[model samples]
Target: MFFFERAIAKQIKNGGGPYFRYIDDLFIVINWPVRHLLKQIERLNNFDENIKLKANIGSFTNFLHLYTENRDGTLFTAVYQKPSYEPYYLPSNSIPPLHMKKNIPFIMLLRTIRYCSTFQTYLSERENLRMASLLNKYPNKIIEQQFNNVLLKFNIDQPLTINNYNKYRQNVLDSPYKEPTGIDYDKVLFIHFTYCSSMEMFPLKFHTLWSKSFGESPINEITPVLRIRNVKNLQRRLTH
Candidate 1:
């Protein structure tokens, strides 16, 4: 596929246009008739038997989850969602830890900030996220707190203006996220136990016990990763 894309890109370059390819997705721009571009794409399609290319020619299109349009010599971008997409997330009222519940809204709010080109669009997406969170039994306070945190992260304040949004969006695009180095298993300990509603504070209690037992020892340097396992009920016990 790499070689095929390179060959097709070479062909596209001969016609003097900008072409970009990302994991089987292509974005091509040319100052020629649409029919001419289509013919060129068709020729490229014939270059390989396994790779069949389809062209989407339009002034506005969704590419890589972004709805972009060329409007009056300017480009406008917004987050795009397919018609079949549903807003479903982990229920805040579930048995997960409080941090995980808070993370649901925090991550979504960050995504909304990343993908929305304007503040107005981001506000609309935030409202949608709030509604979805409510449907999932999430507290409204958590959603609002996360939203405010995102605004603070981006240095956005009340009476938001397009200039602020444009600056924030540009800053985000210029500095794409780099995935942080994952946990060091060598420096961690895994502790697992059966989970119950009453054991919600087990982690904190365990930490306190550890500090009293080994606070001065080298073992204290190792992080303890606590995990919970759901205990099976009578129905599942019989089935298993």
Candidate 2:
């Protein structure tokens, strides 16, 4: 992937438009004629037989899980879910640590805030999450509390408007403080754990073991971040 990207970087850069690449997905913002854009895409596709590219061009496009639309020269974005997306979340009745289960709502609410660029978009996504929570058997009051928690964390006291959304959205990214100054660490490791309904105690056990092994290390500190999976339905493949 690296070599192929390096080989085509110049062609893409010189093609005369702003382009961004995340892994194999490419997003290009162009104001040229459609004919010229197609020609450039064809040229990119022919760069390497092994490295084929699929291009979609329009005023609206889905990139990096956000639906971005250009309306009268202004850009609007909202969270995008594929057609096959399922609304499954960690079951509220699952046998997990109480805190983990309680955090489900907050984690999801944060995502809604982060992805929905407009106030209306945020409300729409929040409604969808509320419905999904109902299907998952989560209590309505719990969901409401979670919503309030997210609003408080973002310092949103009034009704969410486009201006407030933009302000607090940037604040979420800026809220985390930088690592304490003057602390030196030889190595840093970011460990991620996936949650499974069947293995409720796995994360707790893993953390306990990890602490016993590395708690006395010379590292200044260890921070744990819990990430909730956006996609809950797992597709299984059979191998012969």
Candidate 3:
């Protein structure tokens, strides 16, 4: 996940101009200035490495891998996707590699939610209806309330059941086919995709949403790729 962020950031920094890459799948707005896009491609080509982006764009696969190859000599590789299966493909060269830190499970959950949003339009109406039911059944406000109530009760970040579990349980029991309530899954997806794409232009807004959603000082952890220095950087690059 971090690798995808880094790669997209790298693209924008080098004039790749912001795109999403998940495993072999890639998504880009493709409305950037041609010169900027070209310069990014040129910069990538000049490197002793070849960067390839791929994605299935459907099925929402078990996981995704971000693959890279350095043509100069050895390869620099990173796996952004968590493994869902084994027999993990071994590199032929038997090259031991440096490891990248994985984000916490909650962070992963946030990302998965955001990623799912990108394809909201692509989802079948039935699927969306099902998701809507799920969200309506377990709305974000409810989820946040549940999380907070539990947090306060336990005085720790460790997982715990919400005080209203029985109520939620009863609701579920009463309407087994009904989806969760109060969750704006559609809105969440729309907001996340728009924010990520425009973060370079709206640092303040992006960070604001990030902070609110993740419950932390956004700047401290939300490092935009290209190593965005500050809001000024985002403003300058976006307008330029």
Candidate 4:
């Protein structure tokens, strides 16, 4: 066991009774982690056996609660950390239970990528392919298609030809215009092409997976407890 777990176990034995444990989130809101807590919970469950764990993480929403104490006459009630906007605490007049609020966007392809790095590692290639395909299929979708038209108007049709791809690339790279306009449009096309192609390579299948699971790929809903836990970890690191 980790030192924190051991220390918590010892604290439970010496001080407060059983504690609330969030296994997946790796958080325990107990003053002392009692070694026999699981056994105790099981015994309690026998009396009122309707409770079921919501996730691998232990929380009141999943199971029952028990009471514990502190050295300074504090009442340390042990309950799994229920998903909430605020920290879990006793229902004193000052602190009330905060129900969780969910807000996630669909098509947050960027956000979802952080969880599994497999997609991020190859994002550039994915985006490039997406852009290339998009440009090939939907010429109108290119932000700077007008540039090609302008070149054509100047009777410079060779630049856009497949055989003259390198020449076209060189003209765009060397062009002084850096924006999406008749004068300087390749910049816009290049950027759009890069991301569109990269995203294509990145995989729309993953987006479909997210959509299937959450009803939408762009907007999503995640465990609020997890979001809070992440914020708390960040705060701790910053403070430390």
Candidate 5:
């Protein structure tokens, strides 16, 4: 992927438009004629038999979960969900520990913030999430409080700044564990922590037992695990 991107970087830059790619997904903003764009696509496809380029040229398109519309000279974007999407969330009464339940709303809200580009979009998506919660038998007041808490923490105001909004998301989602600088790893002990209602002592004991069982490497070599919940797939159901 790196080599292919490098090979085409010059061509794309000289094409007189913006081009961005994430992994294998390519997004090109072009002002050229359709025929010219088609020719370019054809040329790209012919460049490598193993790599085939599938191109879609339009004023509106879906890319990486964002629905984008080129209106006049401006671009408008909103969250895009597949037609088969079915909203579902963790039920309030689930058997998991209390901490997991507490974390659920904040995580969901964080995702809502990341995906929705505008306040209206956020409200619409949030309402859909609330409806899902309702289906799961979560209390309306509790859900509202949780939503408000997230908004308060983020200081989110109307007419959102999409770019700046995402900056603090990682901090909200994951607590950092600094790895030691110098360490040799013979074996890696990975501790996966999820929300637990129990006191801090519970994790401490669990960590002890885990270390006893697997043995521990120096903290420096251990990579901190950051779990970011992705509800996109959970939102969809198979249409059978």
Candidate 6:
């Protein structure tokens, strides 16, 4: 990908528009004429037998999860989901870390806010998110609180103004993502299981056994953490 991108970067830059790529997905905004651009793409596809380019030329397009379009002279963007996209989330009543449940709404809202250029678009996506959360058995209070927290963190007011939206979106783009902290794999032990009401005391029993079995050994120094490998809902099961 590095070599392939570099090969075409010069031409794209000379086209006087922005170009972005994340892994194999490429989104290019260029001013080349239709025939010229098609011809260029044809050459790129034939450049390698293993690589093929599928081009869509239009005023509106979807790339990755972003729906971008030209509205009058301005470019607008919103969340893009495929026709088969389903609103599936981790069921609130299911087993998982509390942090995962809490993080879902806030993180999803942040993604929606970043992609939506207008307040109306953000509201539309927010409403969809609210519905999805409800279907996944999440309490209404939790969703409301998470959404409020996101807006508060980004310094956005309700019924967002055009003036405020511009600033809010800028902050989203300008903010740098956090680097992942390194984990000490040797000092930690992970136990994966599917939780049920019957096994409520199993964790405590296991810990007690661990202390008794390894109390005087060096293994006792390691920490044990429980993890739910995965939860299969109807939608995921059907799809898989």
The digit string of per-residue lDDT tens for model 1 on 167-195 reads 76676567666799798988999999887
Q: Candidate 6's error at 12, in angstroms?
A: 2.7
Give lDDT for model 6. 0.84
Q: Give lDDT tens digits, candidate 2, residues 33-107.
A: 778768867876776787676567667889777888889999788889988889998878764455766688898
Candidate 4 error regions (>4 Å): 1-37, 54-105, 108-111, 117-240
TM-score of 2: 0.64
Q: Residue by residue across 1-240, what tens digits does model 6's lDDT show? A: 667778788888887778888888787777878899899899998877876767677789998899999889899999999998999988887666556787899899989989998988988999999999999998999999998888788666674566677777788778788899887999999998876556657778899999999999998999888776556678668998
Candidate number of the best lDDT? 6
Which 10 successive residues of model 5 have the least lDDT summed?
A: 223-232
Instruction: Give every collision pair in model 6.
Output: none
lDDT of every model, 2 decimals: 0.79, 0.74, 0.39, 0.35, 0.65, 0.84
* TM-score-superior candidate, 2 or 6: 6
lDDT over C-alpha atoms for residue 74 of model 2 = 90
- In the range 1-240, model 4's lDDT, one tens digit per residue, is 354456545655576555555552222344323545565445533543443322222322233222233435542232222345232222212111122111111111122222112323224423443354343342323313433344553346653444553454345335564476363332222211222223433334554565578685333544111111222345558887
Worst 10 residues of 6 by lDDT: 154-163
Off by over 4 Å in 2: 46-52, 158-240
Residue pairs with clashing backbones, model 2:
none
The top-ranked prediction according to TM-score is: 1
Candidate 1 all-Cα RMSD = 4.4
Candidate 3 residue-wise lDDT, 1-240, digit = tens = 455356566655676444655564555544465676666556644443445433223222222433333435643332344455332232222211111111122232332322331222212322332343243343344334433443353344443234543343233234434566674443443223322223435646665666677775443443432223323356568897
Ordered by TM-score, highest first, the candidates read 1, 6, 2, 5, 3, 4
lDDT for model 4, on a 0 to 1 scale?
0.35
Measured against the true structure, the TM-scores of the candidates, in listed sequence, are 0.75, 0.64, 0.19, 0.17, 0.57, 0.72
Off-target runs (Cα >4 Å) in candidate 6 are 1-6, 13-17, 47-50, 155-163, 197-225, 231-240
On the 0 to 100 scale, the lDDT of residue 193 in model 4 is 21
